[model samples]
Target chain A: MMKTVKIKKYSGELQDFDMNKLINSLRRSQADENLVQHVARNIVDQVEEGMTTKKIYQMAFNMLKSRSRISASKYNLKKSLMELGSTGFPFEKLVGKLMEFEGFNTQVGVIVQGDCVSHEIDVIAEKENNHYMIECKYHNSQGRFCNVKTPLYVQSRFVDVKQRWKSQVGHDTKLHRGGLYTNTRFTTDAIQYGTCVDLMLVSWDYPPQNSLKARIDKAGLYPLTALATLTKTEKRQLLDKGIVLCKEVYENPILLEQLGINESRQRKILDDSLKLCSAINTLI
Target chain B: MMKTVKIKKYSGELQDFDMNKLINSLRRSQADENLVQHVARNIVDQVEEGMTTKKIYQMAFNMLKSRSRISASKYNLKKSLMELGSTGFPFEKLVGKLMEFEGFNTQVGVIVQGDCVSHEIDVIAEKENNHYMIECKYHNSQGRFCNVKTPLYVQSRFVDVKQRWKSQVGHDTKLHRGGLYTNTRFTTDAIQYGTCVDLMLVSWDYPPQNSLKARIDKAGLYPLTALATLTKTEKRQLLDKGIVLCKEVYENPILLEQLGINESRQRKILDDSLKLCSAINTLI
Candidate 1:
């Protein structure tokens, strides 16, 4: 057997190259198992010792792009989310709109009272008599899970509000609900505890067919980050104006001009958004 | 008007008696405004120039107890909660059990993860598909309200958890909700913010009929603090063993034996619990 090649991680640590990790990541894009394995082998043969994980990812991404654009886009979803912003405000806006699409009256940021204290809730939604307080978890990096403690903490806050309601109001009124919404996945323990406690958990690709990704796809509400033609600044400008979904830009078209993109680029961006919307529609 | 008398507060400061504050408090118990006014005038006439507010409260409580037990119980609710413990752990336990009665599966004193840090959730509850995380803001004094900053901090933790989930799990799981529960009340700002964000707020008599006091009374799950027959240490012992409700002691009379009370007092305690339970049953 040939000697295993050493690779460098983003953290500056060196370790033996792991083929399984790459294969698993590729599989996440829904690439065929045979294609993934072949790509992994080809990338491994071409890899220099001490290559960074980022470099390896780029190489695989490029190779995958040649095979399937849809798979490449799927693979790049996490990276695209990171590009939403450092503060994650853009992600929060996206979540708020998603809730609105789901038919809940949504507010982005507001303060709510508890029995003993006041809290600034990130998002609050109401449907008929039921009220929902949501915490939008946005991440700038991939591979991080909402850990168990988050649910614990969130559950604690909900308990406070519920208790407050019990003390101040008579029992006939409905109890307000609390939920944690994230753009990624939760840890096993988080999922277990969250499920056990009935905390509504929505993470990417979690719960199989009804994840944030699935919901966005179903609603055809892809964020501007999905567009390859748009630059980071253009996406930020659009997001800043509360324009999150690509379909919004696709319909308005004029909004693209506000981003100060050249005529050609604006046309390209709009064209790209149309294609993405259609792609999502076809998938649905 | 007859010469108004100055009274001392628990803080050792002296001030003139305020009839409006007294009337408002009595009104909260659903006392007849005329009766409250008449009672206030009578008490004012009897008050010495340098009597304490505690004395004034006691006089009003005694008079109210004779007039209406429901109002008396409502008035005493805050004081009884304060007596749960100086440390507030006992009260937290009571709140936990109360949540159980309201159809939530409850856990007390758990550590949960947020995106940036881990938090010790005071209470976490689940019902159906909703999880409620609570921060039990138990107070030894009755006047304090949960302030704006507490909710701000709680909301921050929620935001952290949401962000972590986004990073770790590609979006599909629901976000765990948050609440703040206090034995006393929340400030106006807290209420405004909480309502705005849909933070489930439950304070003493906040939402009229469906308050924490109402829930406990409806469930007949009064804490040991509400019992005059038990000493502080005895209450603590029962609380430590997770026996928070007086109804629990009434059903399992042997639990009271653990407190080392003599047979005669045990009979009295049992009788008092029976009376209290019947009173609660009547209210429901």
Candidate 2:
């Protein structure tokens, strides 16, 4: 008989342990300083509406295995996007806000479509006559805005998306207006393009005139949040007032408000709650 | 017509974009992190070994997701693991080493049962009147020894293990001889039991005549490992070489003979890899 060697592989605690107990153990051990645990926490926080605990845990797993190679084929090291703090758990909210600003502020109401394709526009929203496609970039920290793709790529993605939309949505305007939002300022070209299209950019939480981002950071998300006309301090307050209050406050009768929450203040509150609810659901 | 209300919730990123593209973007962002890239790189590493690239990526995906809890879980508003400079990858390999030791040391050529249940045993050879079951515990650090429950669990796991001399095996005292080895002295129970049952609690990789439970920290793994080992620089050198090389050098008697290395040196090397590997893998 041909001789053969056997390979034995040791299984970590998972060999026979319950996953729920394992999660608890992980939550406790998260205090340990390591990349594994940090990513684990991000995955946990991203848990949101309709997500299973199993899927929540799986997010951490998926992130760990993903290879972001600026070109892994060459460098043998996948590029990393962690220069920023945990991308806020409610990533989708940022995209929604940008879409709304692009579509509603203009003549038409925009319908959000497709998830963020990065510079390609996180989502393409449709308005009455024009398509106000938007590219929303979310940053967990102001300094960390250095973490996003180059402005060149952002412009390229937008061009590709715009051209593609012309084929599909027939929004081939000789000139089209689309908004861009990034926590960080745009690369030279992106800024110029915004100027070209009459597209406004909410590059930072702090408006250019007031520098609200710095104040918010110093005062904290709670204090400045209350200062916002639409946003309130209490999560429950937002929940109670609900989107109905938002419509009453923001959506004008002239605009033919279909949304219950039209008021900017009430809408912001509902938006915040919806975001929180999503996070809770995802993590649970 | 009845009145209809379309409410926009203040939620996170969900309504922001097309869900499909969102997944793609997440995947792309994931490739940038080391935790994600390493496994992804390694998964493709075996592509040359006849593993499909897709399978490699998928396996990489599965493996990465498994470590999700280890990646992003943070504490003290800082990274728990990344700051320590320890990636869980090393510990994962440590698990493989622990599982492989016995199979490599099996007296009667190691046989792998590739069935539903898989594991290996050392020294399948029967000893005259007594049938000895050798369970080697190559603890590189801790002085703790397995109690009766250890053998009880292991023996139970041998649901249908075949015995060479089925009747003779029954007659002789079925010695659940545990080969206890560590960098420190065995616990009092382990030492006391050493005299009665077949126990070899030899503290090898520790300081000269140091007590078993000396406070030792996994310094090299200092960031990746949390094992406390003896201050013996020589033993630490073996550990520094990594568990796999240490095992090859330490566990192989022929290699030791050919290398002109003394048995004690080989033994220490083996002890370092065994215990270190076990403790480290457990952390993952």
Candidate 3:
């Protein structure tokens, strides 16, 4: 579903840059050199919905690009969730990581029907005839083991519902089998419940190359535009080695050699990345 | 739609109690008090999903209701939202309030045609035969509304792709209508775009109820079980006198009198609600 946005953004550019952008351009086209920048800031400040970069320029009264300051559009927006602390908790991102590494066959958010909600899981990986329900839970800490009972309660009931519903003569029955995946360990009672319900609790203890460490790095670099932000030399190196994120780029030196960056620029990217790492690290 | 949840809770009694009361009965029946309490806690924690009191007991120990805990099932659920903080930032309850407010209608998340994201508009209003998109930017001080440009920049754009489809004629064309709403004021350019495109922008002022208070309060109550928490004393006033909310109940005491709240209780209700000058005050 997220892919739909990218597809539409491309088509939108072909349609005359959208009316919202056109208006901003018109404003920028009219303003004078010094005033255009001043006006552009003010106009951007006054900007509201249905506004495009075109409308911003038009608002500044500069039809000529040279006449206006800050006349260009912001080409890319890499929402560094690390930099923007308020974005969101990384649970879903972690879920994506877990699924990608384990090769969960289904897309995220697809509800799997099973004997119980615990037996019911987030992503389903079915091949040939055998499949398992994975109940995934993400907890911030072990202290919240008490809270584990609630999710189990839900999963059990959901499994019951699925079983009852499937026993109905006309319903499909294979969908009623899956296991559980949780970030935290279950209590004695929870473990009992999982077993009774035939729920296999998969604890995420950072699975190896298939490990969480590598996947987190890979998921963070899913966007192409963000990779473009690296230095030009770094960019070519990453491209040559197909190293997009700090994780891969750091792990692979061949790519760096291919790009042939000077020691100072390499040091600069590291410094810049360190600052970013500090910011991002604080997010969760 | 939210109203449906409340009305749905009107079963298994409170015995006249409610779903909550019904579950409490199950808790009481357990031979082991500690286990019963732990089970009760699970019910309480997982209540957002509308787990019945019976199910809560079942989760603790299957078919335990044959014991004394049977009575716990009678707690009058009253309303689902009531169990999960009468007014909380949680999504389901927020959805209930948003859907119930006047001029706002939540479509089932689907390929519903609209010019914005599904949950983007905080509140919506109708004006001049168009649905005005609203983004209620709540703050400590009515959010110094110096500009709407950046705010408006975020308004969703719907790209018409029906004609591009192979089954172009088969695709639904009933999407060109519908406006967006926001809690912030629209800029001149935004308003111009709105007028040009038949979209309307409604700004919510800090004294939120200042402008839309009456509309929201009078919008009518949703039937979600969440409403049951108001106590019988509360429900009567809303239904009997057409008082939709506690604010409306306090604002117009004749309804409270009709609900049989003594003048003293009526005053107390009023005192508890004076700060909630608008439905948004209470709704948020």
Judged by TM-score, which candidate is best? 1
Tens digit of per-residue lDDT, candidate 1, span A24-107? 888766567788888888887888899999999999888887876556666676677777777766777778887888898998
For candidate 3, give the lDDT of residue B84: 31
> What is candidate 1's CAPRI-style docking category based on DockQ?
incorrect
The candidate scoring highest on lDDT is: 1
Model 3 alpha-carbon drift over 4 Å, by segment:
A1-89, A92-96, A99-106, A111-121, A146-148, A157-177, A204-284, B1-284
Best by DockQ: 1
| Candidate 3: tens digits of C-alpha lDDT, residues A17-97 | 233343443442223345434544555455554444444444443333234221221111112212212212233333444
Q: What is the C-alpha RMSD of each candidate to the true structure, in Å?
A: 15.6, 30.9, 28.0
Displacement of the residue B80 alpha carbon in candidate 3, Å = 16
Writing each residue's lDDT as its tens digit, candidate 1 over B64-143 gives 86776545555666788887776767777877887898899999988777654566778888787666777788888856
Can you write out model 3's per-residue Cα lDDT over B1-284, one digit (the tens) per residue? 11112212324433222345544454333235565555555545454444454454444444332332221222211222233322222222233354445444543222322311122334333333333333333221222342423222223222211122223453343333334333335555445444443443344322345322223233423222223224654663354433344445555767657667686666655653442333233445
Q: How do all the candidates rank in terms of TM-score, highest first?
A: 1, 2, 3
A51-74 per-residue lDDT for model 2 (tens digits) = 444454445444533421111111
Candidate 1 deviant stretches above 4 angstroms: A1-24, A27-42, A64-71, A101-103, A127-130, A142-145, A163-176, A184-189, A217-220, A278-280, B1-284
lDDT of 1 at B183: 83
Model 2 spans > 4 angstroms off: A1-132, A135-146, A149-166, A169-180, A183-201, A205-224, A227-236, A239-284, B1-284
